[model samples]
Target chain A: MVLNSHQRATIEAAAARIIPADHDPGALEAGVIDYIEQTLATHDGDHAQSYFDGVRELDELARRQFAAEEFSSLGPEQQDRILKLLEEKASPFFSLLVRHTMEGFYGDPRHGGNKDRAGWTMLGFPGPSYPKGYSSPLGWYDGHLPDDFASPKKRSDHEPE
Target chain B: MSRNEAVDVCIIGAGASGLVAAKELSEAGLSVVILERGPWRQRSDFAPEDEISTKRRHFFWPTVEQEPRTWRLNAQSPTEFLSADVQVFSNAMCVGGGTVHYSGLSWRFHESDFRVKSTDGSVAGTSIEDWPISYEDMEPYYEKAEWTIGISGKGWSNPFDPPRRRDYPVPPVARNSAGAILENGCRALGLHPFPTPMAILSRPYDGRPGCVNKGFCSGYGCPVGAKSSALEALLPKALATGRCDIRPLVMAREISVDSGGRAAGVVYIDSAGTEQFQSARLILLAAGGVETPRLLLLSKSSRFPEGVGNSSGLVGKNLMLHAPGPIVIAIFPEAVDGHQGSPCTRVMQDFYKTDSRRGFIRGGFVHPRAHGGDPVDYALQPVHGARWGLKHKDSMRESWRHYLHSHCTGESLPVESNMVDLDPEVKDRFGLPVARITYTSHENDIRLGSFLAKRSREIFEAVKASKVIVPPSRLRKLHNHQMGTCRMGNSPGSSVVDKWCRSHDMPNLFIIDASVFVTSGGLNPALTIEANAFRVCDYIVSEARRGNLG
Candidate 1:
């Protein structure tokens, strides 16, 4: 289920609105669109039709209200207005996109998003402390372990790109 | 080519109950063969410490895409298709069943739990009944389960606890910071908080090490064999007895009954996808609540058209799920770090028994928990108004460590309408009908849940913690303690299995799982199921020695 240029633009723009780019890397910089695309291509192909229907509806709404041809062509303010309409009318699609966006941004990097572990690093998460599990008799209330406890370079080095 | 074998007893599903039965029967010199639907998972299979691979990979449960179940809130509603991954009623499909990935809160139902109907009267719409066997009859078996399976906790701590023959086998697991905070709050409210009885090892026992506080026990298997899963505790001993043959990836299709109306053999799909018939003198069904009823419902013979041992038409009826009533969270300035120790290290059981003043038939327990263990799950919890970006980031940083979650584990009443049956339309990968669930919380259940939720709020307030968040009132569809599809009772008219977990209609067949639970108690049902398994095994062993059973 390859996404067309319009589909890709719509998804990327909508994902950016969910987690917009700022001083820190947001969903766009975190590669959430790629994550969603890969998910739709692989395990979650059943949800592809929902994405198509949602994008079409958003474009239709954009044409009616903002005099825009497509959702991606609109400015940030106009895009948010269309998103709010989607939240009201096509909530199932909007909520699904929001959930997938969160998964792509916050889930493990191996799933195709969270590039450079940006989502985790931004949230001060050290990924999973596998094999060598965390042990603190005093508990997590004491303090977090050093960031050096897990190395992103060493962690991603072993995995196939 | 398919191979045929014969054993004295053919047991389906090598989970908590089946493992115990196999060990007991094999040790008594009876040949036993156990058929497991899923692969034989070992410690190596549980190596993935990440939740994504462990949970998402379907390590503990069946994949919903290929094997789906249909669900409808009531009989009138249109059934919606749900993969086992998304289905709330699904349990483990591995070597040890749900015990492999269970949180290990090993609780014994109080004496009153066994006789809910007799003690508390009927709750209007529900058909609650007393078990054929009393708590006194089950006390010795509970002790045996504790000693053999190795539970860790002090006994007789809770005054509301039933009479115990002995204490737990080992000391309780060490408490995390939340345990201390919960204890202080409960004590301030004049409630007795005790160390929760858990199956996890607190000290090196039976060649297993103590818990190391890894903070991954909720849905993940223990890296070490400290969790006391059947895969870790019982199955190995059953295998050691050479009289037992444990075959994994062998799915039991149906039980074949002889002209005498007794279980004669089982036709199953082996790992190679070849059909094989394993003849046996006796058959035991321990395939959890859903699968046990499903297998029985699937095997419709001329003698039993409505399914075996279902003469009363109750084999797939009376399904009950525990209500994980509204959750109450307390916020503190400091990080209570709930993830560091056992998830259920301590519990306040002040309301374990029913009080008429509470306006509910039975009460629930307040068990404190740590919410934000991992980053992905922590990030999913949003602040009151923050959507994303810096505001969301700020909320995650400030609130993740500070929040402590506690729950009211309440009892769900067993209504005839709430049930598990075969889906007329949907089929699994094996080309068999998948289980369909029809359930809705009873009116009394909703009231009970609301009462419990109110109690949870009071406990959180007593702690003097900031930013208390009470989850919205809703009947949760999630099933942690699913039971009572094939209820056990004295009369064959009202039950599928008798007091000994043997099918009343089929003398040679037995069932020893949560399926035989007449009433689900307010607490977790793992320990009670294990204890009942031990009792049933003892009955089978003695009866077999007397030549009453094959």
Candidate 2:
């Protein structure tokens, strides 16, 4: 409810470019737009004005540069080109967009983003398992210490003066 | 709007020191009241797996917006309010304070740490003072604190560790991939590596379960009471004593003094926004380093115009935040799976002394850390050189499992210019002036940090890391390990508190926290703070028994 349909579309397109879908789910599929919208409506409500201004500016730039009706109407390649230009210019809006995109894609699914634990799944993270913690020999390196490993000799060569 | 009957003792902050003091004093049959500014969170309230809430957001309460602290590089620079996510100088305002979200690296300062000035001689532009008390005086209490609070580690494993009378309460936590790799590399290089002494339960001890290796430590509270925070180890005992009354969500505004220039009580704002006064015969200020001095400065009165116990004009001077040493991130071919246990398992203290050959007076410890598993934190790191698109994603997938960081923590020389004072303008939600911090790391700290970073790189190289990334060194802002604001010394003209941690100007007022630290050692300060609290509380109990604490 914090953003109109046009604003939402523009932000979703922007987030999609920031974390495009390939073999795995990306920002759009992970519901990054919903996360951004919810954040704007709540804790980060103060930045809503800047977000609106940024979205409008992005649309304006898309039309002026690519002859598109809006940023979302542009092809993936054109969207990427505009994003790269914004990045090169060190645009504050672009930085904010990228930061929010990452948060939505990587943050916990409880926040309405990273839907179905898509981010955790991609990273092979088993989320928060509190009551049940893992035992030692957690990885290949720990279980397979070098074959010639020996108990370290107690040496004071580097002892403090 | 309300006045409460006098208690035997009134302590501000239900933190590491205050809670310990409460348990000790109340057990000795003294009626005590503790005022904590944040909510008393239960174990169930902690979400160990949610990085966004626990790590990204200020899950510790009193976010920067709620109580803003302004900071500047030095007196000449303009102060800026710190952001919510800036980890620098951020302390949890909850019942356990920073211990609630701490990494549990418990350290006993070496003998040389107490006499830094004597050991290293004078460093120009720094106020390196020897502690009024020595390690020998603190050793017994250190033993007491470890046993009472449940520390887990092998005694004398760290050859650089100070002499101790007894071993830890429990054995060390099991080592993970990062620790094993670091051990191998360190042994190859002839460096000493030991299991880190931690304040977490390795096995079930004192009715608390052992850590589950949930990979959600440091910034997150233990959901299973595995972490031996003051909240878990001390507060419950204090409450059971039936003489310790903990009032959470109560902000102490000022330490009120009697007309005779003696400590009287504390004036605080209760949860319902009502002003209340709770009279006490004795007062203990354990509000950590910054807030302890800020509270002292806020307690200005006609009898003590320069603020209570600040006649020496050193109430907030000689601030020392432990130097943020460099971190070396390495990527190996095989997965480290760092998310299987606590971030740190092994520590190298080979350089934890004054080594002139290293081009720095004080040295630091290096530890291989397993803190790279969090997706949000991992993605936010700019080491990949790509901000977005397929390249960034590709790098993330490739490097997420293989990354391990070797972190160094060094000693920060106490500088007189670095200080905490009442801000000239900004105020908190209580309408009181906020604490303004002016700080800049000493040159020696930077030298030591960079030197340790190179050592870390050597360790990584020895382990055959595919890539070792050492970021450019930058000036550190205030870190979490704050110390030396209200210094303790033998001379009343040079320090705020006496060797017993009692205020020099007031007989009945005591400060039992890191604020009383004479010098910051090259390690975490939680254990020392707890030990000092025990020693100070013992003195308080004996004084109360003799009717000498008026």
RMSD of each: 6.1, 4.2
Over B1-550, each residue of candidate 2 has an lDDT whose tens digit, in order, gives: 5899899999999989999999999999999999999999999999867877777767884577788888899999989987665543477889999888888989999999999999998989999999999999999999999999999888988888889888999887767778877888888899888888888898899999988777777788888899999999999999999999999999999999888888889999999999999999999999989899999999998777889999999998988987767668888888888888877777789999887887779877888888736777778788886889888888888888888877788899999999999999999999999989898999898888888888888888888889999987655666778899999999999999999999999999999999999889989999999999999999998888888986
lDDT of each candidate versus the true structure:
0.79, 0.86
What's the residue-level lDDT of B335 in candidate 2? 83
State how far residue B290 of model 2 sits from its true place (Å): 0.6
Please give the distance, in angstroms, between residue A51's alpha carbon in candidate 1 and its true position after superposition.
4.4
Would you list the clashing residue pairs of candidate 1? B64-B84
Q: Report the poorest 10 consecutive residues by lDDT, candidate 2 chain B.
A: B82-91
* CA displacement after TM-score superposition, residue A28 of candidate 1 (Å): 2.7
- Cand. 1 TM to true fold: 0.90
lDDT of 2 by residue, A4-118 (tens): 9999999999899899899988899999998898878876788788789988888888999988889999999999999888899998889888887888998877777899878
Instruction: Kindly report which residue stretches of model 2 are placed more than 4 angstroms away from their true locations once superposed.
Output: A146-161
RMSD over all Cα atoms, model 1: 6.1
Model 1 lDDT, residue B114, Cα: 90
